[model samples]
Each structure stands twice: as C-alpha cells, then as structure tokens.
Target: MQKRRRFKQTKTLGQRLAEEVTRLRDQARALPPGRSREMLLRKARQDETAIQIESWLRSPGLRAPT
Candidate 1:
C-alpha cells in the first residue's frame, strides 16, 4: 500500500486563485495582441470563474436538497 502525502495550505483556495488570476492578467497585458496573449487572458478568466464558484459553494445562503 502507498501512503498519500498530505500538507496544509497557508491560504484559502479563493486567495490562491485570486493571486493566479492577477498574475495571469499581468502577464497577458505585457504581451502583444496574439494567440499567446489570448490564451493567458482565457486562463485568467477561468481562474476568476473558479473563484466565483468556490465562493458560491461556501456561501451560508446555499442549502442542500432535503
């Protein structure tokens, strides 16, 4: 049997994702308009969406099915 390695994260998932989105946007801004730039922007958008989803999931207003 193999043991799974586990480690604690110092920051919440939202914080990490927000950081990545900021980094991606900065990188994209430095690049000229082209496929590569578009890709970076797309990735940033994806990360932003993930952040939104995570917040939604953690919201106290959300309720599971009865």
Candidate 2:
C-alpha cells in the first residue's frame, strides 16, 4: 500500500527549502567521501540562505520572490 500526502499550502519558500535540505542532507550522508564534501557544503549554504530569505519575507513590508 502507498501513503498519501496532504496538500496544504506552504507559507514560505523556506518551508519548501527545509524539506529539500532534509533530503539533501540524507543524500549527502549516503554519498562516498570524495563526492560528499562540496555537495553537502553547498546544500547547507542554500538552506541557510533560504532561512534568511524566509525570515526576511515575514517582515511587514518585505517583497515576495519573483
């Protein structure tokens, strides 16, 4: 049997990115040593950037992503 996912609207890009980051981290962990370093670091940076942007988007007058 397969499980179904609920279709709730996401409030911010960070929420989406968080899910992606989680997946990336899992993949990074499974990667062979030589291939993991840069990929993991890049994903971490993207996650951090998403967090900052998402927080910024919550500001009273902040602009949405294009």
Candidate 3:
C-alpha cells in the first residue's frame, strides 16, 4: 500500500465539489452511452471522491474539512 501523507493542504468546499463533478463528468465521457467498463479502474480516486462529495452534500450537519 502507498504510505499516506502525514499532512496535506485541504481544498475549499467549493473546490472539492467542483473537482468531484469534473471527475465524474470525465468518467462519463470516457464511456459509451449503452455500455460501460466491466471493471472501471480508471479514475478510481476521482470516482471515490465524487461519491464522498455526494454523501457530504446529503448530510445536514456536514461541514467543510479543516
């Protein structure tokens, strides 16, 4: 496994949301309308980040990470 960074500069709420949206859109564009990859390993991090963003948006008490 890759070692995680001990500390990193976090992005702003808007920036994170935008990045997620961008990644999802890119992934969508990379696929065909009627077909999809059997195992989409492409942009996995982006896909995960986008899902996290979606979940955050659904939580009423969620706050921007500090």
Highest lDDT model number: 1
lDDT of 3 by residue, 1-66 (tens): 999879664976556666765666677678776435323434555566776777778779989855
- Whose lDDT is higher: candidate 2's or candidate 3's? 2
Error of 2 at 25 (Å): 0.4
Q: Write the per-residue lDDT of candidate 1 for residues 1-66, one digit (tens) a residue.
A: 999999999999999999999999999999999999999999999999899889889989887524
Which one wins by lDDT: 1 or 3? 1
lDDT of each: 0.93, 0.77, 0.64
lDDT of 2 by residue, 3-66 (tens): 9988877555777777788878777777777656667869877897878876877878887765
TM-scores, all models, native as reference: 0.85, 0.57, 0.38
Q: Can you tell me which runs of candidate 1 are displaced by over 4 Å?
A: 63-66
Worst 10 residues of 3 by lDDT: 34-43
RMSD of candidates 1 onward, in order: 3.6, 6.4, 7.8
- TM-score of model 1 vs. true structure: 0.85
